[model samples]
Target: MAPKSDSAEAIVLNFVNEQNRPLNSQNVADSLQKFNLKKAGIQKALDNLADSGKISFKEYGKQKIYLARQDQFDIPNSEELNQMKEENAQVQQQLDEQKRAISEVEGEIKNLQSNLTLEQIRHKEAKLQKEVKEMEDKLVKLRKGVTLVRPEERKAIAEMYSEKLSQWRKRKRMFKDVWDAITENLPKDLKEFKEELGLEYDEDVGVSLQSFSGLLQHGKK
Candidate 1:
């Protein structure tokens, strides 16, 4: 009975196809040692592959040398090489355009930060954030066939950004709530206690009220 075509046969054939050179069963078995396949199993897979016409073999005395069929591979000619070069140039041009777009957005963000009103800044920030996300999606699509970044690395970066964005959003809501609570209950004589209350609150440090009079006395146990 012929040996069944299984993972062992597939692995052996893939290695043979990639090598494109005549390899003995021992050679294939050695190359696939990491798979922990037994020598007998490898020999059986090799025979199955040869029988299935997935590979060809030449008998050299007592041993058979196996190789993938040459016709299965497309050997690129000059015209094909030129077409690949043109495609590569077009991808590079697209990459350059993306970089320019990112730079323009960054510059606009900086300008808005320096000169825009608070409400305008928030509006523009939200718009720029959306634009940046769209640009990132485009970058991921463009990098599909290229080796600029590995898939794992891209995933890690995306996760990191998502985590940071979530934290920022949480803090923004917290700060807004705290500001509202402090403003609504402020004393009518705001100018007299303005310096004592230390009204300058930051998102990172939170609401810093140096002296809230008797408001915080209840929690002073």
Candidate 2:
């Protein structure tokens, strides 16, 4: 059944139809800014619009912006429309291929990063494991009365092992890089770490690893 009440959505759509700017949530919000309505909630309501012919989509920056598409937008000739569609499809295809290639390269870089990180962790863990083994060996000899274990000596061993345990924990925590130089694989701990460090994470703030890597590789000239 059609919605029993579509007043709010109807209002938003009608407003868009009335003012035919390259509209976005901000535009819609700006239209309603004088009212007591929540501008943020207005954006949300518009976002929930159904795909059944009332709403239209356009990509602005990295987000989808909506507008109304109804009877009035003049129809182009079938051949020209088809040609436009074909060109759009070609561009979309090229974009998809580029994205796929970028994704593959990013995956390789992340894997390399993960592997390198794990290798470093493994090295530290190995060194700590060796220390643990060496401590156990020394304790065994001391137990046999081969040499007396001083109180400070015992404290030193305990402290060393505790430090090693803490180091291993830190390494294990950083096992994966979710944010790579490309950001396709940013560190999994990134958000938490950022939160802990009181940092803000901006989605579009920084250069992606792929672009940055390209700059480093090719920009020298």
Candidate 3:
């Protein structure tokens, strides 16, 4: 089966890398004729590769000329080299900012836990954890050079993250309701006594309400 023709994107990228020169979509499509790829597929693959930073492009009037990312590095002029250095510096700054943001969120979680009730603590912790995780995921993608330049595309990404934040909030609310209902009448003495016994709900004890209630009942007996 002619090795399954690789992928359309891979074929397009390989052809550009081998040619080591800027090529229009038609040039790419012509080169891949042996692979029986369609012009539309070749064009889409080229666009995607460029968007992902695996390939670079130049604009000539209405046409976008595509070339392999490595091709740009191979024979860099002084200006191009300086631009690459600036781009690297920007990426490093972004990484530092993401790390600082993560640390700040962690500090906030710790501070909130100090003065918050158990339910409040859990709610804040869950919300912050979700945010931190999302940031970390974005940092990884950024480190991999995933760039989204379109405003509408960025808006879609923001909406997706907002949905995730909402889901986290809903989870925190559910857990808070369950926790408040179960411990509504829990005496202060018993609460202190549970702490004294060190039967704290470590992950080993399980995270369910039943586990906590069981520990309280055991203490009473």
RMSD of each: 26.3, 29.8, 30.2
* Residue clash pairs of candidate 1: none
Clashing pairs in 3: none
Which window of 10 residues has the lowest lDDT sum in candidate 3?
212-221
Candidate achieving higher TM-score, 1 or 3: 1
Q: What is the lDDT of residue 190 in candidate 2?
A: 62
Badly placed stretches (over 4 Å) of model 1 are 1-6, 82-221
How accurate locally, in lDDT, is each candidate?
0.79, 0.68, 0.78
Q: Write down the worst ten-residue block by lDDT for model 1.
A: 212-221
Tell me each candidate's TM-score.
Answer: 0.35, 0.29, 0.31
For candidate 2, list the clashing residue pairs, or say none.
178-185, 178-186, 178-187, 179-185, 179-186, 179-187, 180-185, 180-186, 181-209, 182-209
Q: Write the candidate numbers in order of decreasing lDDT.
A: 1, 3, 2
Model 1 score (lDDT): 0.79
Off by over 4 Å in 3: 1-5, 71-221
- The digit string of per-residue lDDT tens for model 2 on 1-221 reads 33334466667767776775567787788787665557777776677663555677777688767766756677789999999999999999999999999999999998887675766889999999999999999899988888566778977866765565566556534533433433455555666756776754323466343443354357331
